[model samples]
Target: MTTRTSRRAGGRQARQALRAAPLAKETRPVRAGLEGGAYKPLTQAGMERIHQAALDALEQIGLADAPQSGIEIMTRAGAILGDDGRLRFPRALVEDMLAKAAKNITLHGRDPQHDMNLSGTRVHYGTAGAAVHMVDVDGREYRDSTVQDLHDAARIADQLDNIHFLQRPMVCRDIPDNRDMDLNSIYACVAGTTKHIGTSFTEPDFVDDGIELLHMMAGGEDKWRARPFVSNSNCFVVPPMKFATESCEVMEKVIAAGMPVLLLSAGMSTATAPPTLAGTIVQAVAECLAGVVYVNAIKPGHPAIFGTWPFVVDLRSGAMSGGSGEQALLAAGCSQMHQFYGLPGGAASGFSDAKLPDMQAGWEQMCSNVMAGLSGLNMVYEAAGMHASLLGFCHESLILGDDIIGQALRCVRGIEVTEDAVDLDLMRSVCLGGPGHYLGEDQTLSLMQTEYVYPTLGDRTSPKEWAEVGKPDLVQAAKTRKETILAETSRAHLDPIVDQAIRARFNIHLPR
Candidate 1:
């Protein structure tokens, strides 16, 4: 009896030790660039039809209101500037430009370790949106989001292993000037995280200031150009096939500055686009294809993400239905279209119509995020913290999203079948003559950490244990974690000298 008890104690200690050990970067079960093409929502024929429809829309319908510069650039590259003031793309010209477009591009981060290889079906999830309200979970209230809130979100995302990139998630509502707001937004993101960032410019004139700020942060202009840690999330096209003229100009300047661009086409279905899901996809694809021609015309093979972001709307009230099942299908279908063209692509997901992070929010966010990862989206934007149809962002919800995304990435990782994984020697030993269970087996302990994923904030305790621990609420736990993270000093900021120089040169509104 003594010997048996000793053996049990030793096995328990070994299991505890294995669980406590930290996993190496390479050994983590889920990571940034896991491949995920296992959930194609469109058949080959359906995708082909969508592609042909997009081409038809571009060729037959065309898009209007291009700035004179864009008209000149595209016309020089074989686009037809119609007398109707629309720019039409020939199928052949589009094919040629598509040939010149860059593929398998890398989105560099300030820290090289965070670089994301956006090629094939590799998946990376991050935050993106222009929410004006910050969800105060404790007070159950909504307030305007400030630059400080943006920085705090970035700092929180920096500590999360699952959030691979940090895009400007909220507007600096406190800053009234558009140019200052633009500059401060970029500064806040870079200061809070070393990950690759995406931001937008209110006007084409502000692109120069944003570039200067990036150059200072990167140590020099040449260094910034080489890596270009930031990308412009340009909404170059207005819905239902028209150019956002100023935004198009911003795209040109951003590309010239050696920064990448996300050619975002966000059309609200049934309002700016067709009500049918397939029709919305077609319109978004067509608009982005026109954007592709415009971009490759400016600079052949310049890095651009084909951002076809079509949002859903509830017809009864004409409200955006960000958390609906239809929205998930829209994002997945758009991802498939990007795969069809062999270009890096992104789409919006993980939004919630609920005002708070409740049960409804949980299901809505998880369903779309899982589908987005499984559909092989290169960059999954707005994958966390968005609430109230994307009008609000919650820091606590963002922290909870890290745990949710971890699980989604595990699904993206899927199952691996190999000789060792399937070999039944250990199983046979346990079943036939050993302990009659695999709990204490050497193989069990070895594979435990590698073969499975554990959530940092999600609970998996038994009812008795959970009750014994005073029944901790998930939202409360997330709020506590958020507070702890923000209270801790962060090392993600820039060098003191460079920061001072930037502050002097620009009217940075954020506090030191």
Candidate 2:
């Protein structure tokens, strides 16, 4: 009896020690840019049909409201300016641009360790949205999201391993001027994290200022161009085939500055787009293909993400249902379209219609995120920290989302069938000569960290153990973690002198 107790206790100690040990980046069970594509929501024939329909839409329906400059550039690239002023694309022209568009693009980070190599079926997840309200989880209420809230969110995200990139998730509603709001958004995100960032400019004139701020952050314009870590998430097209004129101009300037562009086509189904899911995807594809032509025309082989963000709406109420199963299918189907075009693409997922990160939010966020990762989306935006159908952002939810994405990424990794993995010798030996079980096997201990993922806040204790630990609530635990992260000062921000210079030159909103 004594020997058996000692053996069990020793086994427990070994596992605890192993759990506390640091793992090399390569050995971690989940990480950025894991290969996916195992899930095919669209068949090859269906994808081919969608492609043809999109091409036909471009050739016949075309897109209206292109800026005069866009008209000139695309017209030169073989797009015909119709009598009604819509820019119609020739099938040959789209094909040429598709061939000319940049592939296997890299989104650089201020730190080299965070750079993402976007190629093949490599999948990366991150946060992206413009929620105006911040969910106060403790209060169970929403309030205006301030610049400080944005900064805090970024800092919290910087420490999360599963959040690969940090986009401006919430707006600076405290700032009154549009230009200051845009510039401050950049400052807050860049100052908080060294990961790759995605943001948008409100006006074309603001592009130069935004670039100047980036140059300052990068130490110089030449150096910034060498490793442009920020990307412009431009909503270049409105739903149902129309161009957003101001955003188009902003795209041109950002491209000239050598920053990557995300050609975002966000249409609301059953409202801005067709009611059918297939038709919604076709419109989004056609619109983004037009954007592809526009981008390549401005600069041959520019890096642009095919952002097909088609939103779903509840038919009865005409409200956005970002957490519905239909939303998951829309994102997954769009990922298939991105693969079909052979372009680095991104789509929206992980949003929750729930007011808080509760049971409904858990299922909603997980369903779409898992589907998006499995479908091999090159970039999965809004994969964390969005709630209230994207009207609210929650910091505690963002912290909780890290754990959720870890599990989702594990699913993306799927099963590996190596010779060693399937070997029966170890099993045979364990059953025959070893103790009746493999609990203390050397191989079992070694594979603990690599073969499985353990969540940071997920409870895996028995009911008795849970009582001993005070039965910690998940949301409260996340809240505590959020506070702990924001309490510590980060070393990733710019040096004091550089920050002072930036404050002097630009209207920096967040306090020092």
The sequence of per-residue lDDT tens digits that candidate 2 reaches over residues 1-512 is 67657767788888889999999988999999999999988899999999999999999989999999999999998999989999999999999999999887999999989999888789999999999999998899999999999899889889999999988999999998999999999999998999999999999999999999999999999999999999999999988899999999999999999999999999999999999999999999999999999999999888899999999999889889999999999999999999898899999999899999999999999999999999999899998899999999999999999999999999999999999889998899878865677666677888889999999998999999999989999999999998898888974789899999999999998889
lDDT of 2 at 353: 94
Candidate 1, residues 242-274, lDDT tens digits: the string is 999999999999999999999999999999999
Candidate 2 runs further than 4 Å off? 1-7
**In model 2, what lDDT does residue 55 have?**
98
lDDT of 2 at 317: 90
TM-score of each: 0.99, 0.98
Overall lDDT per candidate, in order of appearance: 0.94, 0.93
Clashing residue pairs in candidate 2 (N, C-alpha, C atoms within 3 angstroms):
none
Error of 2 at 12 (Å): 2.6
